[model samples]
Target chain A: MYGKKVKLRIFFFSIIFLAILLTTFLILKSLEENVVYFISPSDVKVLPELSKKKIRIGGMVKKDSIETNAKEILFIITDYKSEIKVSFSGSIPNLFAEEKGVVAEGFLKDRNYFTAKKILAKHDENYMPPEVKKALESKK
Target chain B: MFNIFSPSKIFSITSRATKYVFAIFILIISVGLIEALFLSPKDYIQSDSVRIMYVHVPAAWISLGIFSLIALLSISILIFKNKTFSLIAKSLAPSGFIFSIIALVTGSIWGKPTWGTWWAWDARITSMLILGLFYLMYIVAWRVISPNNANKVTSIIAIIGVVNIPVIKFSVDWWSTLHQPSSINILSKSTIHHSMLVPLIIMTAAFALFSLLIFLMKYNTELIKIKNKGLDRL
Candidate 1:
């Protein structure tokens, strides 16, 4: 058996540890509804009645699927299997491009349509742009 | 293990090694700086701003690493009654706190340019902030309590605070985050290009060496103070 001080210390910290664990569990449980996850278009298709809570839909930008008006930009996010139309009024991220990965956050108006509040473009790890790649190829 | 590193031997090695660590730290840091500032390619998307990751990620890694070390040292103190474990933990806390602060500040700076906002309640950010807060609380516990009482109390705090480490590590996977997923992976080929990855690795090495230098200097000072006070031989 350990000394009295070591025993007391362990007991003290065990109480603290349990308290922290309980607090974390309760917080995560309470915020469960808000823990949105990136879902592909096919996942959206399988979802039940849509709620007002915000969610993120992630996939590639379908080629030539972008349409821009004076105010709003409309695009389709595709997972190569299915697609969801996203409409946004705000400016998009710098990395946003056709045929690139993107995740849009907003409420779904329907199974086929998403009214986006934000657009985040995913950048690949490749540092060389196509043009730079071409230039380097020619140099080689 | 405790007797293996006698106080006199620990003092001799640390004093001798400090100069060498300082030299190596300076050399590696210089190379890291050059690579980060000039040699590394900018992100195709984030442009030059991506350079911040070189410092930010490494600082975060160090903060987590040091906290883990402190947790291990605390266990050694509590279970094995290793006399030198508490001193080692004391030596590590200040640097861990500094790294935590650096990680937070640099993360905020990176977030502003990349995320288009200064701060958010994203799970990763929130967890990192909590980790930094724990580091602050650990340092404060050591300072406020009497020396006789502080060792056990701080050890308990360090041991318990380890819960936050896993939270910090898995926060990205557990919740939706504005922060991107990790580019560097241990199990597979990392997503980052070698052009950028080289600098990041160099910076991380530099930071690790710098922490070693700092820990050695701090440990020597703490040991000297203890010796002067006629507390223990070490």
Candidate 2:
């Protein structure tokens, strides 16, 4: 049998642990919308109504979907389920390229159109040498 | 086992161990640096920029590991009323705080070139920043609170802080963060190539040894303080 002191300590520890767990859960749940860094094209497409507030759209740069002129750059971001057109007049990260992951931040003009004030690149977790990458591509 | 926790005994053992830990730490860290900086292959996409992973990832892992350790020790102190455990936790915290800062700074530096931003309020990043704050608070609690009450106060802070560790680990999965999902998976195959993984593992071991060295030095000093106060037992 456990001593009275041990029982009391265990009860106290459990109470504190559970209280912290519940509080963290509620806090994270309340901040769910904000914690999501960006929404995909599919999620944006199904929005009940469009607002003037700025939002970010994240996906891959649809292969060969880029068009550039002296003034602005145009590209399509696709999540494989849906696609959105993005236009930006700012400098892009070095990692931004066709068939690479990207996130664009700005306002939504329509379900299909996005005007981006900033373009941030996203990369996958894979790491290898350039030669190994080339060899993998050649094998494919 | 109880005798080992005596201040005089721990002081003598740690003083001897510190020298060996330092020598091994220097040797391993030198090897780790060479492997991470020169021997490892560059990323196919990010190229040389990926080298920053050598420092950033290990610092993050160490900080998280150390915080978890401190929490466990705090729990032990609460249940057992062990002053030795409290002293150990106190000594371990500063290195954990330093490593968390290192992780945040290195991550921010890496983000600028790769993510196109210096900072983002994404789930993973925000949780990591909160972790750094928690470490700061824990260290400050030790200093601000009176010695008689410092143990109870710091233990509560540490236990509460541990809730964030799981959140930090799962943030990438739970939300759409700018940070990528972890490449090192214990339950599955890792995505990183062996060449890069080798250097990462070595660097992690080296960092762990360095933290141990720091912990020993801090702990020995605390023990010496107790000895000077003419206490044989903590």
Best by lDDT: 2
lDDT per residue (tens digit) for residues B170-215 in model 2? 9989988889999999998888988999999999999999899999
Candidate 2, A1-140: lDDT as tens digits: 76789789978998989999999999999988888999999999899999899999999999999999999999999999999999999899999999998999999999999999999999787888888899999999
DockQ for every prediction shown: 0.27, 0.87
lDDT of 1 at A122: 55
Best by DockQ: 2
Q: What fraction of the true interface contacts does model 1 reproduce? A: 0.20
Using TM-score as the measure, which candidate wins? 2
Model 1: pairs clashing at backbone N, Cα or C within 3 Å:
none
TM-scores, in order shown? 0.82, 0.98
lDDT of 2 at B190: 88
